[model samples]
Target: MTALSELNDDVVRSMSIGAVFSDFDGKINCLDFHRTADLLVTSSDDDSVRFYDIATARLVKTTYHKKHGADRICFTHHPSSIICSSKHNPDSNGEFLRYLSMYDNRCLRYFKGHKERVVSLCMSPVNDGFMSGSLDHTVRMWDLRVNACQGIMHLQGRPTVAYDQQGLVFAASMEGGVIKLFDSRSYDKGPFDTFLVGGDTAEICDIKFSNDGKSMLLTTTNNTVYLLDAYHGEKKCGFSMDTSPTATIEATFTPDGQYVLSGSGDGNLHAWNISDEPNKVGSWDSYIGVVSCLRWAPRRVMFAAAAASVLTFWIPNDAKSEPGAPNPEG
Candidate 1:
């Protein structure tokens, strides 16, 4: 099916959990999709990583890291290799990230730098460069070719980092609602522009750029998500979710960048239209618990949400096929 078929408000509203995977024993901490493949990867508190073939709608493989444990995982440029944080395991020394080859179940390399647990991790859309934001109040940059950190930025409060669609720039959101934009090549020189969100004054849960790189998305612990102009840093709008004191509900922009969706404290998946004025467009049924993680496929007509031990995929019931389909950033 063409991705545009699923982007319609009615199609989005018609979406419901079409598939459910309950193999996880503990909460799923992170999940990512292969950049140009129909594969999905997820890591959970159960100390396991699972891979799925989204094109076939089947679980492909499962690997365990019982010793070091797995959390905050993402695929490197290569689908067989993944980089993951190992802070949940007591045996692991603090702040060591693992580059693992899941095909053979081997540790490829260890990336060490952060003094505290990493709360956020993302790969650059255009290259091998990746970033990790830590509770240590620092954001570190790395490349797949290097085991050592390439660069790091210190900031106050909890830090979340994200790169624009082109990977030409990266943005960092911190406590006190401060957001700084840095040129990818010379971030060390300091942010070229900074925007103060004014009043959030809380730990940031996530930050993201729209597929077109025209807007920025920020979610905070105070249960608010803000949409902003990427070029001028003007607030386009803000959406309030349920009061979620315990979970970090992530908000993701649709692949077309016309709408945004998030998990809420009430256990439902909520969506809003942010292209002009912000309005609640739809709120799907409860996802069993607070949906701590939600992602839209970067090129597909699908999305997924995880809460507690269940991972559910959403799709329109009558989605029709075309010659090609674009996906979302799951």
Candidate 2:
């Protein structure tokens, strides 16, 4: 059931089971599914953000990004709020970025900081704080409840933000090749520790905490993925794909944490068995371009992947594939 279409040179469209609609026009850069609501929110390149009714497959509302399209967007666990940012505009020195915006219908606020483009964004699970990483070489936390913008903690280079189950923060940098950990409660108290993964150079695009938060999966710009112990910082396993460097945009664990799924620049979603073996799994290649964002839906027993334009819903298969799931080509 892959919706087949050519959105653009930079975008692709593919189909999957639970997805009602897919936009292949590069209108959306990043998207997230609300945990309890039948809604989907997307941040796009056209300086606009949109909300969609998943059940009806229709756009609900659009919020202006104010500049160019946003590079990323995320919904707060609060269920009523959202946070988003755009790519660093070199002319702005990465400061005063129109990046870092939040919305809740009752109120909307834009965070002013980060001299460079804010490439990474996330909300803290244990608290009301939000974190962002930028090309300006810092990670900052914001308290939405208090409306305060906390200043930077030096990660020494551009970093990506990931949080573990215990609420500790991980900041993986572009220059240091290490992952920095900070206790969500330890800010302003003292120094934080960094976890270095040797032998990798390209910028870390994204890092995710495993289901139990015992381990984390790291993705680099060079299309490399590694599983590392969350506590000891020891390496668990490393894997790479034959596709272009783009496919490794994000790596996430299944809702049950029994499987791992990653989106690639080569326009495919690779699902691997976390418990069955290590590398044995399946892949879906219906999108036209890079699969930029991915999220798992446990209640539906499926996951979703978004490229520049389209979105696809994926379901696991047994010997008899499900009705909507196309057989794996790899």
Candidate 3:
């Protein structure tokens, strides 16, 4: 197997959109790839959840939540299940965090605790547990086998929660540009480490840990992305470009941690090389609306980007070439 550090820049530059799926009636809110399968799931404002087979580039199933509608979604350890936040029955009030079985479109569990909309949801990398950050200023943890919230933490700001690749540490980004790191095994003791970023005016939209669990990435509504040392909470780098004041650009690190990617309101996707000086390396125009969601496939040399109602999958032009091989067209 080729080491990720050995990935050729030419291969990275050769990436191009290979497939486009346009079926959503509304904007795509989130996209997640199954860790162990060539499958992906997306939630949209259209109140639906759709699954696709990445290998076949085919839409496999579509499920609807007509009442409140689905928003953020993450696939669980089980291939046939997913957890999403959606509205509850109108009469009951508030929203519900649902664990749904894709095999039969049944909601196997409902973790109903968030008093407001859940803006962030992430499944634990090593177990059937998951965590969610909500506008209600709380982070709630849940176990798939149970219907109740296992733990909860109140935050001073709207929270964005994520578990590291090893599931040993979980980070929570909250108001006032504060990020608190907690030991997953004993989070109730309070965060063991904390770091601050941005300013009072900045709103953190997302937080993600690198695949190797060595670093973390934070995306802000201020159109800036920060790379931080996961072990010590030290800032590594910050990425940004000229963007609209209203743009909520979401950024992500490549699966190999060699590059960082973000979607801009200017209808383009941007990538930066992170190994050396962080510099803009590539940009692709989607020609659609604001590219809101961007995700690299966990186990392949491909990624998927969504903007408005369009979804596009990108792959290296010579993806099948052997490692260390020169590009024929170059």
Candidate 4:
């Protein structure tokens, strides 16, 4: 594993926009990169789901859901499959979580239960089972092979959920800056531990566990991002941005967990060096719109950011010159 102290601000500042995909008609909701490949999956408010070849920086597949547009999307354990929580139709009693076969754009399974929009969805790192948190004040677990929900937990307010890298623990952020951690093996009995961020009244927009499982990142609607110790949930530091009043901006850590990246309503991408004093190290003007979604590649130094209708791929300028470095350009 790469040490966080070894990363410098220059390398992060060297990141430049390498490619851009601008075909979506609405704002990009989320971006997910394959754990072992250069493939990328994205969901948009335009009612479309897209697959892209990151190396070639081209669209590989495109599918649409006209009725209820896709929101939170993630790639399953299978390379050719994905799951997304979408809006509920008129006749439906609740929202539907669709597991789609990417090869044919067919719905393989539908998990339903949330009475409102499902705002958070995260796939388990080691299993086919995944979990979701919704505006309906519920968190439900599902398996990709089955249509029935496995378990459900009700909360007081909106929730943002995430799984640790080891898949042994999952965390759900609820109202009042509280985070509930559950053991994946026995979640039905209730959370084994809970952590609260003091003095924060913002609604958490998203939560992410570092790849090393040592740290966690939380993005809130109040334009702030909080870093915490994954095990004890002690607040390490926090970063803030100028976010739009209605936008749910996201943030993520680099693959090595050295730095934090976030999008801003000011059309800039922000980065902070986590190993040093908590401070802004780099900022790139995307110049697209309010950056709505941000994600880092699972095994590379690259990352992707999306705004209103554009997706941009970023890479370090010296990546090509470094010996044995993976080429960003195909």
Top-down lDDT ranking: 4, 1, 3, 2
Please report, in order, the local distance difference test score of every candidate based on alpha carbons: 0.82, 0.62, 0.81, 0.83
Ranking by TM-score: 1, 4, 3, 2
Per-candidate TM-score against the hidden true structure: 0.93, 0.78, 0.91, 0.93
In candidate 2, stretches whose alpha carbon ends up further than 4 angstroms from where it belongs are 1-20, 24-27, 35-38, 53-59, 66-68, 87-107, 166-174, 189-193, 243-248, 316-330
Model 1 Cα RMSD, 1 decimal: 3.2
- Better-scoring candidate (TM-score), 2 or 3: 3
Question: TM-score for model 2?
Answer: 0.78
lDDT of 1 by residue, 14-85 (tens): 777656888798889888888778888999999999998776467788998988788788888898889999
Model 1: residue 143 alpha-carbon error in angstroms:
1.7
Clashes of each: 13, 15, 0, 0
Of 1 and 2, the candidate ranking higher by TM-score: 1
lDDT of 4 by residue, 178-283 (tens): 9999999999888999999889898887999998999999988887889999989999998778969667678989877878998887778888988756778988
How big is the positional error of residue 269 in model 4, measured in Å on the Cα after superposition?
1.6
| Per-residue accuracy of model 2 over 1-330 as CA lDDT, tens digit each | 211122111111122444434543444567777656766677766666677654434567776645445567777775556776755343443333232333434335556667777777777666667788877787888876554577577666667886665566544455746876766777666437667888877677788887577777888777777887777888877777545643446677765555677766666667666654466466677454676677764334445666666665554333114453333331
Which is the leading candidate under lDDT? 4
